[model samples]
Target: MGDLTLHGSVSPDSLKEVDQFDGQEMSAAEKARLEQIVWRKLDRWVLPIATIFYLLSFLDRSNIANARVAGMQTSLKMSNYQYSIALTMTYVPYIAAEFPSNLLLKYVGPRWMLPTMVTIWGLVATMQGVVKTYSGLLACRFFLGLMEGGLFPGLVLYLSFFYPRERLQIRVATFFASASLSGAFSGLLAAAITNIDGKGGRPGWAWIFILEGIFTFLFGFTCFFILPNSPATATFFSTKERHYVLARLKEDGAVSSDDKSDNFSWIEVLRCFKSLHVLMLTPVLFVLGVTLYGLAYFEPTIVAGLGYTGNKAQLMSAPPFVVAFVVSMITAVIADRYNCRGFMIIFFTFCNVVGFAMFYAAKSNHVRYGSLFLTITGCYCSAPPAITWVTNNSAPHVRRATSVAIAFIMTNAGGILATWLMGSLSPAPNYTKATLTNLIMSIASCVLACVNLAYLWRQNRLKAERRQLMTQADEPEGMGDESAWFVYKL
Candidate 1:
């Protein structure tokens, strides 16, 4: 056995049939170099495309907040409740479509499904500019939700097919940071777009929708050409490179037997529901969702309440999200390196608790405005790690897909409460009710995260005990994270 050779002509499928390293043995240094090459290639091919698509998806979904400040509510003659209803309408279809969309992503490759969804949502978002009545606004939002619903969960599932659990946190964080970037960029973009008021016989809010929608629409077409289906089938790589990448993933236990097939299984779906961890984690995501979506949709409004009305408020919203983007990346790197997803989630959620507590009790506008940094960074930081925690634990292709869908559905369900709270508290000058609601939700999120951490620690202890009684050879293949050899990362 010597160093393995990667020629341009070798097929990826042929490598799967071999013993992986049967004919060739490489030195430890060579193996490390090969893995580095694969990772760098994947980083180039997958991460950027997914991050850009999510940025646009979030920008399209949450731009209503930007539009609200720009006069969409008044232009459509909508009350706070009606505007909230319109916001709520987006999540109704969004929630309904998540499970089915994950299932559909299994049938239609991500190359097609993800981009198609983005394109449709972009068109719907654009139509929002033309709606004259509140009913029309509601209709457009519903369709927008229907189109955008699958993207986040779909991307989560898609990434699992490529990276192992330990390496996944940073990639998921990189992808999710796009949402925070969109928050910051939306404020700056909205401030600029609002200056286009009365252009083309349209209000500034209408221009905001039309222009952002066009950018999203164009980006979707670009993704079609760049996004790969899987490492085995990626066209951008040479045949040998593809083969090496897929083989490495299998050696790492990142690629399971179920991942090789596209067949739908009812048994796998049932298995997803039976997992005690998933059951506990679902509600945890729900609570985190309440804090995250609440802040995302209303942070600008909260800023406006500090006496910076109109465009200044929109401009002010950028700083908190900028802080969130920085904190989320740093936390993700530390979580991945230390294998401490659970601890990091609890720490960040506590940051939210403290931030919101200050916001609720503060009298000065400056103090309240400063509190935004803590709240935004904490909420955003906890989210990616929490999501990665679930994906890392769920095994087999179908189970992972179904689990992610369930988690996202619960997350979006919180959006319904968030929008309603914003509307209900709209009449208050200080936004006392909304701030209090966020403070309570942040505290609840921290408690739930702590509970889940305890549960995982117990499970890990039980697994260690069982492992001591059995040999490695006794473990079965393809059991995914549930295999006796597979220790849970707490």
Candidate 2:
């Protein structure tokens, strides 16, 4: 079936299509045990594969920063400001097509969708190595972003099918930490690739894209056999296991079928825009996205400006991202254990606020660098949990899909703003404007976090009041979904 026809609320007809063998339902305890085993199996294959794919995607896209320092600009005769435009072009399509791509994923399926994207972008990445002029480079980067847009939102929707809302925080975190891994790895990879001297006279930066793109293309083709579409159609698991997984999901009030969500309500797309939680959460993610892209798009340039050689700057860039990855994992595990998404996110945003102030106020190079480490670590550490909470609170099926896609779409739109904030006109050695811009973004994120906390608290209070007035026989199905419920976690 086409993807657009593969989702929605579970109608009787739809349920019949997905109903498992024996028509037997298991107890809650049996469900729990099966979930444990399923997660173990999932961790073995799902997390690692998804994480690696995103890591490579991130690395290939952002390595241009490292390439800039590796003499890419000089070789191509592009100015510093032109580099920023190149970066902005990447986000153009990435933001424009994000939500639509999720809708498309309904029919295409990840088995085919993800790999096709990977293959397309991988080819683009390889072509990046061959670009001889500024326009050529811009064209490659724009196409790269266009192809990569579907990946994140699609994966977010895909993960929702297998994992319930409560268990998804750390899983999402694990996936997002791939960005930090890429941040660290990009430097090392660029360093190695920069050393490659081809007989054809291509520069090392070109080789970076070519080599990374090749792996991405190959991995995409491979994921077809590996990435499960949903509990309904997962090929790796036994039919009974698939049935068990589906039943467990019903317990969470998350609905699924082989039908497209667009079949039910196109207005559902706008529903996400109207949610208070979404409105507040989107800007918080927006600020963080800006910071992430700012760093990803320009970290190598910033490091190079610090008086280190290109190679040394790339090497130094690894440590801060390493710190971020470790901190992100720790935060994820803690948030999941406590079921306290809001508090942890606010805490991390606060850390960024402090880190940014420290960077802006500091005089010494050592102090400034230390502040940079803290800033990157804290903001990145919080992002996954914040995003996970936003997506999980949404309704099942298409609502969840649209909500998740909006979060990414909104966030990458901020990438465009961040790109413009640190214009190429700034002095090379001290990007005073960029540093201050990050500080502003950090503060903005913190403010958004607090606003969301308050909004969630108010909604919960209202819901509690509504419950108090309801008769025993009369209650709305606990908000939107039948089994899934939203509680303010702050």
Once model 1 is optimally superposed onto the true structure by TM-score, how far is the C-alpha of residue 475 displaced, in angstroms?
A: 5.2
The deviation in Å at residue 298 for candidate 1 is 1.2
Residues 1-490, candidate 1: write the lDDT tens digits.
0011111111234445324454665566766767787778889999998899889988998889999999988898998888788889999999999999988785778889899998888899999998889999999999999999999998988887777678899999998998999999999999999998999899999999999999889889888888888887777777656667767555555563343323467877887888887887777688777778877888888888789999899999999999899989998999999999989888988888888888878899999899889988887888899899988887666677788999999999988888887677545446667768777777777777788888878877887787799775676544555665556677
What is candidate 2's CA lDDT for residue 205?
76
Q: Candidate 1: minimum summed lDDT over ten consecutive residues — where?
A: 1-10
**Judged by lDDT against the true structure, how good is candidate 2?**
0.74
Per-residue lDDT value at 131 in model 2? 90
Say which candidate scores most in lDDT. 1
User: Best by TM-score, which number?
Assistant: 1
**TM-score, one value per model:** 0.92, 0.90
The lowest-lDDT stretch of 10 consecutive residues in candidate 2 is 1-10
List pairs with backbone clashes in candidate 2: 3-106, 3-107, 5-259, 5-260, 6-258, 6-259, 6-260, 7-259, 7-260
In model 1, the Cα lDDT at residue 282 comes to: 78
Please provide, for model 2 over 231-291, each residue's C-alpha lDDT reduced to its tens digit, 9 standing for 90 to 100: 6666667766766666556545455443433354666667767878888888788888877
